[model samples]
Target: MRVVGNYRNPGPQDEYSQGQGGYPPVSQPAPVRTEVNAGRLWAGGVAAAVVAALIGLVGVLVARAVFQLSPKSSSAFGDDATVQLCVVAALAALMATGIAHLLLVSTPSPLSYFGWIVGLLTVAAVVVPFLGSGSLVVRLSEAVIHLVIGIAIGGLVSNAAGSASRLTLGENR
Candidate 1:
């Protein structure tokens, strides 16, 4: 059988021989087969935007609640403080989430649905208790809310900042 690319004891005049110059004709060097679809770009970008928006919403609620409960004695959250804190927290969360998506995930997949679920559940953790917590329920409910919010916030931040480093360093881990 004649084998393609076989170079066993090639003749003197054959390519790769001492007489003939090395390297293939420069006309082409194997055209690269690339799959660049606009759909993929749009899907990834929108998914990223949605995650950012959700992070914003969840962060606003959680931050507002936490700040409200801070030891500072204020009858009502000053307009400037409440608005500024929520905005900062939301923007931080959104940017963190987008950065996370870019770093952590290779090839955008359905895995980000997991983020959506976690973000939503984190919001629920806070909202449910505030609406009705008359007994020891307030403490338990707030604890759950804080834990979930912390997890969501921390995960987003870490995923964004440390994804590449973690992947390269933690290969065996």
Candidate 2:
């Protein structure tokens, strides 16, 4: 018998000539399953926090030295600007990482949703300072700081989610 296709000669049990077959049926490979690595996610979170804190520190320095603006808090307890900004940035980074982890575990498309969440939060943070009774320079500086922190958190965490995951194939679905 002549084989009409590129497939190798069929075996005795193969039914290539059953009906409209040119070659034996090919079995499809199994789908791959991906699992996230929690340790890498945590490392990314820490790195993001450190970067955000540095950004906040730089913002504070620029506000004070370059713009000649002093940031004042509306809270009851007077707080050091540098310390408060850095702490808040770090906390925000950690919070973003937690949210990212939850989304990655629960949702199929984590990055898209995470981006929306971080972007909206960043907008709110920027707008919040404008509503307060701060000088233009202070408001602008705070907004910049918030923007930088948001970028760091969103970019780093999403990248981490990709890097920390492992894909396993050939497993039964």
Q: What is the lDDT of residue 136 in candidate 1?
A: 52
Q: Which runs in model 2 stand beyond 4 Å of their true positions? A: 1-33, 70-79, 167-173
lDDT of 2 by residue, 42-137 (tens): 899999999988888877776677775543652322247678888999999999989988877777677789999999998898888889886787
Candidate 2, residue 5: the lDDT equals: 52
Task: State TM-scores per candidate.
Answer: 0.30, 0.73
lDDT assessment of candidate 1: 0.46
lDDT of 2: 0.79
- Alpha carbon lDDT at 27, candidate 1: 39
Badly placed stretches (over 4 Å) of model 1 are 1-9, 12-29, 67-173
Can you write out model 1's per-residue Cα lDDT over 66-153, one digit (the tens) per residue? 6544335543443444455345445545554554455344433323654664466556645654666455544564545444544556
Worst 10 residues of 2 by lDDT: 70-79
